[model samples]
Target: MTAAITATKAFGATSTTDEVLEGVNLAGKRVLVTGVSAGLGVETARALAAHGAEVVGAARDLGKAKGATEKAFGKTNGLTLVELDLASFASVRAAADGLVADGRRFDLVICNAGVMATPSGKTADGFETQFGTNHLGHFTFVNRIASLMRPGARLVNLSSAGHQMSDVDLDDPNFERTPYDPWAAYGRSKTANILFAVEFDRRHRERGIRAAAVHPGGIQTELSHHLDDDARRRMTEVVEELARRPGARPFSYKSIPQGAATSVWAAVVGKADEVGGRYCEDCHVAETIDAEGFTFAGVRPYALDPEHAKALWAKSEAMVGERFP
Candidate 1:
């Protein structure tokens, strides 16, 4: 099926939060956004709350999240903060359970929290740090609360163009057998984000729920905190290469507001339903990347394969030791 919204709206690569959300009213709508301590997460929550949506901001530290929200959004009435640390399965379960007990039906859930290229480490459950926190953490959290989502709810997984870096290695997701590369691990986790959304939409759309993965474009966010000097230099070289490609969109950094635009659009845009299971960027369903030129901004074909998505979903369930619809 074609995308419900194939063309970009008034917003573009440079558009800000208020600009993208102009004319939208979300009064009484309940939403959840992860990683609200700073950067895109804070701007996302602030912008949505400004538009009248009741936003629940999840962070690893409740104090930081509350302070950040207040600093960014200024004591908004509809915004609340919750503690969530994606590295620990127990934390993920407890956070979901708390939300469930609150009894608030969420209309949208944005899995925006993730780690970047970090040193090799294992999570509380013994999974690779990047894969565990970025994909598995959100995976278990969403499944635990899937039933609590209101019908027609939107699930937005914050994927990345870095998904082009690698496909998920299901057999060794924790890098037990193969040597670990930080960027490769991060890429696999990002790819898992897309695959998760693809399979999630397949399973849940019939029940009035839909999921989509989003690439928020190049932005300076705390997600890059783990990037050392060498890593940053390599990333710069890649961006420079992309910038030199013929017909490639110019590589540029986005303000936090601009970076948060696509996620907000996916969450509340009217035509978002048409692109369920699709990867989105710049406020629209992104094109598939061509094998010859990786400069174009779009998803890689492997990230959207239904078979791969399904396989990854099963693998994820096994890792988490739980079954989910």
Candidate 2:
């Protein structure tokens, strides 16, 4: 489904979280925001909580998450913390089980936690670090809590424009047979995130659950901590090239509130259901680009394929040793 509300100049590339959520009240709603210890996750949770939603901030360090939530939401009346570590299947399962034990239902699940281009490594379960932590980890977590989603619940997966760098290679997701390129692996994982949302929406929309993928605009966040001096230079050159494109807004960093805008927009915007199974950016469904040079914006066609999404979902279930059903 396409968005009922088309992209408008009013909410442009520089829109902030509070701007996107203006006048939208989320009273009595329950939201789960992963990786809320810092960066976009914290801002996403903060914005939602400020609008009166019960926000659960999931992170690996509960103490740090508490402090972060306190800082973001002040007294933490509308915010809570849960322990989760996407790199570990055990941690993911434990977190989900605990949430289930609480008998709470979530109106939205935002998979906002992820590691970007990092050095080649394996997750605790022997999967590639980027793909494993960013894709499979969220895959298992979502499946485990599938039944707890309230009717009309939305699942928002945080993808990236970096997905244009590569497509998923289902046969060697662990990098066992091919040389590992950190950027390519990150791209594949981001693509997987988009595809996961596509398949998820297809499977669950009938049950009143819809999913969407979001590419939060480029921001200088902790997610870039792995970049070295040379890596940062290369990224800067790419962004500069993107800025030079005709009619393109110059590439610029976003504040935490700005980076979290699309996410909050996807989670609660009234017309979001119309755009289920699509990738979004800048507070609306992103355009599809087919150019050669760095476009820096929009979703790639392959990342939205339903077939690729289904295949990845099956492979993820096998790798994690759990079936969604």
Candidate 3:
């Protein structure tokens, strides 16, 4: 399967992150962005900080994160670095516990750190690498920090259009019974991200907490670290071949800043006040797509199924051995 293509107008397709957020003032607002050491994470943090938000840059490597913060903010006072490695449940617990202990409130929590197709690997907690860090890890983190998010707070899960590749297989999510394919595993994790938002919103919307899953348009980033040079080259060829196919709508690749647009928009947009549990792409709520292949576009029906959302939530709780409010 290909990416989920959406026709919805992007709020800032060609615009840089700073431009889309030009007039928004996040002064005194507190934001924490995972994966902030580089790529879209840095862009997201930079945009928030540029708008005067007190940005907490969370990454696995504190040193790299600090350096990235400096590069983005230039020794500014608005950004701080926090250590977080989502693959380790202990790390997630420690990070959230620290925040909870601080008695601080957060306006936004961007669950942005994620891994792509990689060789079969397990997290410190014995879960699949991508699913562990991308979905279940974020799930545990959000639950721990739920009390810290004030009413009207936003939680953004960085999902991908790659979700179209597959749905959550509750019976064998860790690939114990089924054969493991890197892309399939990634797709399942991405689907978990969407369902997490759906279930979270269903439970928390009345509390004024909303959740959104977003597909940042593809950009050349470090998120593909799991792919070797040969694999990367093959993917590049795939994209090029798909682009050249007759009548094929070329995939619109975004620059790093543009790739971060949808995330920033979902995070800070005033208009998104009532929007929750929806999958968004290109900065707007995506349409539903039924077809497959590289040109595949929009959210599929299964992706938005409330029943599946509940089921996935229950399964996730059992898998992670934690409950979320």
Candidate 4:
């Protein structure tokens, strides 16, 4: 039997991106990050570039991405933008194929682009919005560019604690029959993110390519913009109750740097074998929590179930209408 994965006490939810990446040098490393137009994506790219890595930022709007990076990073030492709309398979294929054609190897790939609590809608390809953009888009793009990942490279999928909300519904991923609930849909997609990493790790470990999923903690970024005032207030109350501490405002969730810490930590700082095929948060490997209701920490067993990961992989290939050998 394999040894268990454990968390590192070196950093927790409060650590910032720079803190986790403090002493690491990435001079010759190249990384691809999605959703760099805003939020953790921009921050993740900035932090990585600040540490000397060549960062290729992907966004639906190149202009917006360039503006955001300029506003955030100020100086672009090793940063460039790629147009990618995760909600559409055509765009996904084009972007991935372009990278493959370029034949540039990447040391890390951070699937950081995603939407949360989005309205009921289908992707350009007719898949559910959250699942299509967050899970399937990354699925197709990553697999297509699999050849460009250097040996010993790693893939980081930005999952969430919201994954505790629901598991993947392979029978009805499109919500054709089930009534569409925003959070549940978000949960399913996030859960899919974890399962994808698990399966990807299994498939590529022999080639030294590892994958892990992480929750970047909560930050009031563009990701939560879909929720209105009432929804936002309710979310705040839930977080307050979870914290069980007085004056636990939602605004106190996490700073952008702190929020992006786990992404960089998992991608380059953490122990590769220990983090391979696992779900992490707060810059450490989270324990597997098997219980009802949201404990607000650790990962659910279903998110790490190997059989479930395999099942999702098969289903994803079918949904995307392509199989990766």
Question: Candidates' TM-scores?
Answer: 0.95, 0.94, 0.92, 0.94
lDDT for 206 (candidate 3): 87
Task: Give me the runs in candidate 2 sitting further than 4 Å from their true place.
Answer: 1-9
- Candidate 3 on 155-242: residue-level lDDT in tens? 8899987798788899988899998888888889999999999988888878888888888878888898889776678567767877
Candidate 2 local distance difference test against the native: 0.87
> Looking at candidate 4, what is the lDDT of residue 5?
26
Cα miss at 296, model 1 (Å)? 5.5
Q: What lDDT tens digits, residue by residue, belong to model 2 across residues 117-199?
A: 88888899888999999999999999889888988899999999999988899999988899988888999999999999999
lDDT of 4 by residue, 1-325 (tens): 0112243349888999877876677888899999999989999999989888899999999999999999998977699889999999999999998999899999999999999888889999999999999999999999999999988999999999999989999999999999998889999999999999999999999999999999987788999889967667867776767777454433357999999999988998888898999999888999999988665788999999999999999999998999996
In model 1, the clashing pairs are: none
Question: RMSD (Cα, Å) of candidate 2?
Answer: 2.8
Cα lDDT over the full model 1: 0.87
Relative to the true structure, how large is the alpha-carbon lDDT of every model? 0.87, 0.87, 0.82, 0.90
For model 1, the stretches where C-alpha displacement exceeds 4 angstroms are 1-8, 292-296
Cα error of candidate 4 at position 26, Å:
0.4
Ranking by lDDT: 4, 1, 2, 3
Model 4, residue 20: distance off in Å is 1.2
Best by lDDT: 4
Instruction: Give the least accurate 10-residue stretch of model 3, judged by summed lDDT.
Output: 1-10
Q: Candidate 4, clashing residue pairs? A: none
